[model samples]
Target chain A: MSSPERRTADGLERAQQLVRLKRYEQPDEGYFEGFLKEFQQRQRADLMQRSSRSLFCERLGTYLADFGGRRMLLAGGAACALALLFVRVAPEGQPVDAGFDAPRGEVTPVSAGPLFEGEIDLWEGMVVPAGDEEIDLPLFMVEPFDSRRAAGEPEIIEL
Target chain B: MADVKKRKPDEDRGLVERAKDGDTAAFDELVTKYSPKLYGLVYHMTSNHEDTNDLLQDIFAKAYRSLRRFRGRSAFYTWIYSISVNMTLNFLKKRNRHWKISLDDVDSAIEFDKEFIEQTSKTDPVRESNIHELQLRLNEAMMELSDDHRAVVTMFDIQGMPHNEIAKILKVSPGTVRSRLFYAHRQLQNHLEEFRR
Candidate 1:
């Protein structure tokens, strides 16, 4: 029996032999002669298929590379920097409210509920009225105001 | 007496320059010169004539479009061969999972090859009829390899490119190319074991 390395060498040699035989595989006659013409036709078709915009870009890139390799790159960089600076320093087109102290109209306090199960004067530090009887407030009176209503606007009660 | 000729490297360089400058005739000369060689490289990898033809057309078209960037860092031969290998590998990746083995007829001229004669002499006389079958099986075995290994094998074994040339075209070290070839050859041997005897 051949050694492992020797067996491998023999196998590789045989494989190479088989591969050498592959050179005999050739295309039909006149194939090579027509290949150039076919390639030209295909090249034309490809060119026609490409968009004019991409073709322009490709040509422009070639022109720039050939004309000013380093200077053009620096100029492009400077242009981009200037554009960014313009964007950064440009006016936002809106007034700036620096103090945030714009005058708002008077806001009436919204009462949470009766403090002592009866009528209480909210302005007098929760003092219940002396002659008023203890009356149960209606459920509707205790409900939270609808957000859809205008701010600081009092809701009209319908009897 | 026939005149002896020496191929000048500058000939291709001049053609490349002209092609870059939009001379289609010069580019046509390049296409005519390289297409047959590229066809072999692609056809071996694909194992299909129709695919090879379509791929060869696209490869040439791409090379033409990209000729402006051909910076002369490498030989035109090496550069174009690199393009062909890359495009073929990409094509194989996108090819159908159930790729069918389609081989062209093995040229009868191969019978004249010394290796072919010696191998045939050892095999049974009836083995002559099995050439087509053997070719099919070889292609199937080749298809079993990964695209990287297959590329190495196709370039080295079939195209007879030097390991360094394959390495340059593949952008890898010669050591890597040898390793890939070694593994690929082992796989092929196991696959084609029936013919070993």
Candidate 2:
């Protein structure tokens, strides 16, 4: 026998030519009939599988609808309860009554505490300084308290 | 095997319609009617009789399940072909591995061809033998193609489907179908070039 590969090549060429020439034909009746039979059997089996799966899905749906459905309802209910619980537990930042605001212009000043006692006051000896020369007390001379500082500005605070 | 007289074309059409409408018996009739072709398709694509049998079962099962969704956009035959092609491609994808091409046990066409060639072999053994070898190699080369290429080849070359019909079935443009056939045939020619000698 010639090399199988060589034979195979010839056959391949012929087949391609045949296919190209539109000479390729379907099988004979007996073969088709056999195929039809096999197809029928397969279809029946397929139908059965589909029905089985359909039945399974239907059963599953029904199960979910019947006894098992409560789980979802319970889940929904649990979610609602948790949400309400969170609403209750979480802090509310609404402005609490900054009790009554006095009318805009009706401001009041409080009485000062007692003046400096003897030992700490070298200031008691000094007269009120002359014109354009306001006497600078240590309290006044020190840098004024910055409101931004008191309100937490300059986030990088020096120790 | 007891022969089940195949349904007439019109009856087959009706069966497909009924099956599409959720009639199990009609679908069963269709399965009976077309199983062999579909099996051949799956078998050729998979190259394993057992795998073909199993895949055939699943293909029909899927077709039956999805029958309700099959709009008669294409002929039921074309529609079923589409299903077969899709299923086969899906199977190949899931396999993610190379598969060899295996023809069904010498089809009548092959048998007849063999007989004709052998008769001629008595006079020109070398030439005829070359042809036989070439055909086998062609089949082997065809099988070595990716499933997509193989599918287009089967439809166009083996089944003699029109480009339009194949395009519709494959959900691709006719140009794509033609290009695939061209490439597949070229590959086959190259693989079987020695036979041209």
Candidate 3:
């Protein structure tokens, strides 16, 4: 770092004095007049070439600026307030909302009225019996010519 | 420190109002009023006549486009200076280190300036140096500075703007402006002290 000594200041002061000579560097005479004319031409060309969107915005801005500072401030404040409305702040002690309008449907438990007193039957129709019983045939008495007995007592003849 | 005309805010308000109302004549007045000063500011920064010319044209064009946004929050002087400084700084940033220094002709009127001659007489080396050569060396020394530093130095040293005014233009604190000026002056001294100073 250069110290702030008298000798150092002198050297810098001399250099600074030289730097001041930059003021003499000027464009040729009548440059300002020419600059204005050239600028006017370019300004007209640029404005002519601009899209309607930019022109509208420029017109709107100029209109707004014409409405005075108080109105501008009011408009700015209203915009901020509107922006704040859209920004939902989370309540204290609640987890912040990261979801953006997620689906929300309610759940309902199915009601088949109240329960009755009974063991619940889960296997009611699948049982079968074991086959190990002995069978005796009755002695058959042979009765021949039983056609008349067909109508007697509703015909209970065992075969 | 320069023949650059000072701005008049009261007169500016009327002209700005008129210009805002689509008075091309009033806008022309502003363009005429400010071009030379703005030219000097930008020329010193870029160290190129063509770049300065183009940039000056652009600066005024931008100001003209942005006229509606200019509420009297700051003086037109400060507002336009802000625009020029910002645009030139951006231009310099984009053109970084890829520049060829092209300067304008030193006005012949400088020959008749007694104060400059007197100041040079006080310094043996500066007095002994050729005016054209000294001017070139000075511009080269200026280019050695960073864009930010060069900006403050150009505005403060060459343009003779008050530190507070420069602070306003840069939107930085006055201390920042002063600090930049201090370091810039130091660097310039170092560069020029080897021979020119």
After TM-score superposition, what is the CA distance of residue B35 in candidate 1 from its true location, in Å? 0.6
Chain B TM-scores across candidates: 0.85, 0.75, 0.86
Residue-by-residue lDDT tens digits, candidate 2, A1-159: 579877666665554654442122234557545654676676566557766777788657655665557798899999999979977776688544446984556668977974432222333434344445555556543444456778977756689
Q: For this target, which candidate reaches the highest TM-score against the unseen true structure?
A: 1
DockQ of candidate 3 against the true complex: 0.32
Candidate with top lDDT is 3
TM-score of each: 0.70, 0.53, 0.68
Superposed by TM-score, candidate 3 places the C-alpha of residue B91 at a distance from the truth, in angstroms, of 1.0
lDDT of 3 by residue, A1-159 (tens): 456576887787877877886776677678888888899898889989999998998888777767876888998999999868756564667755656976668989988973333232223322122334322222242233454476564676689
Q: What are the runs in model 1 whose C-alpha is more than 4 Å off?
A: A65-75, A78-159, B1-11, B102-129
Least accurate 10 contiguous residues by lDDT in model 1 chain A: A120-129
* Model 2 spans > 4 angstroms off: A1-15, A18-159, B1-13, B20-22, B96-109, B112-127, B130-135
Could you tell me the lDDT of residue A150 within candidate 3?
A: 62
Location of the lowest summed lDDT over 10 successive residues in candidate 2 chain A: A18-27
